[model samples]
Target: MNKKPNVAIVGATGMVGHAFLKVLEERNFPVKDIRLLASGRSKGKKIKFCGNDFKVEELVKGSFKDIDIALFSAGAAISKEFAPLAVKAGAVVVDNSSAFRMDPGVPLVVPEVNPKAIQRHKGIIANPNCSTIQMVVVLKPLHDAARIKRIVVSSYQSASGWGKEAVDQLWAETEQIIKSRIQHPGSSIKVDGVKKVLPAQIAFNVIPQIDVFLPNRYTKEEMKMVNETRKIMEDDSIKITATCVRVGVFISHAEAVNIETEKKLTPEEATEILRHSAGVEVIDDISKEKYPLPIDAAGKDASFVGRIRADESVENGLNLWIVSDNLRKGAALNAVQIAELLIK
Candidate 1:
């Protein structure tokens, strides 16, 4: 820890992986060396770091031999198989997958929320789901103040959340729609493209299902919110219900959240609390039609919150809208912050 640590970015060719590199460069994270590892298809690919090019290596047993910290954004199965080997190779792993999150031993973390949980990691630190990360960052300060009892959240997740292929699918589908509109002139028409994402196409519409469905009818993505929230909050009794939807946007992930607290909150008071919280930016101003939008938060690290008000339907209920760059704070940036905490 005396000198800057040598780091490895697992899945370095993926979208989240690319963001990790960007954040590391933007924040000027001290790295004596960097190893960008990906699958065989991406091997030998070059990515720029600090204006210098580095060749991507295929991940293997010895990949982490000299690495001190590993940031894992590969999918869960990859993380499940490779994370331990990296840890055994003497590197601390911060995983951005659902692999080790509920493992009782691994720390489920949002640096802004339960940073104290970092000390509990058994080699792998789990970054909560992207949607969960943004929601909890905004909730922790409020929950600390009012004690959240139950949370109901519906996410408008971007195509990027499903990975690069989904983003490409969205672009391809959108182009087809534009072409169809031009050909049809004033007549209404529907265009369909090769179905590369979701069950169907993802153009000019929203897909309510995200990830795969479970026997209980809720998606695995939805369950991640419930389980991850409880673990990150360190309160098993906290109730959470989530509906994860895939949207056509290609960057930020947005959510509509309603919470039941132990105590009542006024809109003015809630705004005051969030205004003073770290890593939170309030953008509510109906008079000027100003509010948090996906594009506004596409490249930002902070969570943008707006539309704060008390729910009239239930006592002690508060409603909020939250958005953030999923690839940043949701995955890469959060992992980088955890690494910073560890090295400190």
Candidate 2:
């Protein structure tokens, strides 16, 4: 910790990787060195960081030599293969994949919520899922005042959560449909059966399932929200049910979260607490039609909360609408914040 650390960014050409560079620069992270890494196909690619271009190196078994920290945004398979090697080379890893998230020994950290979790890292720290990270940022402050009993959350996730291809396809399909409609007036198009990334058309529709369905009938993404929220909040018994849907949005994710707590808090009281909480921004003014939207949250670090109102059914029921850029605060910014925690 005496000097600036040398950083290595795995999957440096991807969306999350690009966000990591921006967050690091925007936050002015001290960097003695930076190594951009990716697959063989991306080797020799030029990436701009800190006002300079760095060539992308092919990721290899020995890529972590003399590295101080490694930020991983690759898929789970790649993380499962290379993350341990990074750790073995004495670099602390902040992984954005689900590979080690549920590992009891690995700390799942969100710097704003449970920063202490990072101190217990055995070398590899897991970043919570995108949806889970943004939600916990809003829920933690409220949970601290009134212990939450149950949560029912429905997510309107963006295409970027899947990958670059999903985002590209969303726009491509949208344009294709528009052109098709122009060429053939009042004609029905069979577009649902064709897709590059999703099973159905995402241009003018929403997909109910984000990941594969489990035997319990919940999608894997829904279960992730349930499990990751508990682990991040350090609560096991909190009942949570999630329904994740993929919307046609391109950047940020929005969620409708209903909370049941042991104690009551007026809407104004909850709004005040969230306004003062770290990494949270409150914009609940229903009279003005002001609330957190995906477009408003895009490229932002803070989680935006609004639609603050009481659920009249239960004693302490509250409804909140949370939004944050899935790529920034959810993945890359959180990883960068973890690095900041280590250095401080």
Report model 2's TM-score to 2 decimal places: 0.96
- The alpha-carbon deviation from the true structure for residue 44 of candidate 2, after best TM-score superposition, in angstroms, is 0.9
Backbone N/Cα/C clashes per model: 0, 0
Give the alpha carbon lDDT tens digit for every residue of 9-106 in model 2.
99898989999999999999999999999999999999999889999999999999999999999899999999999999999999999999999999
- Per-residue lDDT for 1-344 in model 1, tens only? 42599999999999999999999999999999999999999999999999999999999888998899999988999999999999998999999999998999899999989999999777899998899999999998898998999999999999998889888888877887787555444442343544475765666667889989999999999999999999898889899999999888999999999999998878888899999998899999989989999998999999999999889999899999999999999999999999999888
Error of 1 at 266 (Å): 0.8
Estimate the TM-score of every prediction.
Answer: 0.96, 0.96
lDDT of 2 at 230: 97
Global lDDT of each candidate: 0.90, 0.92
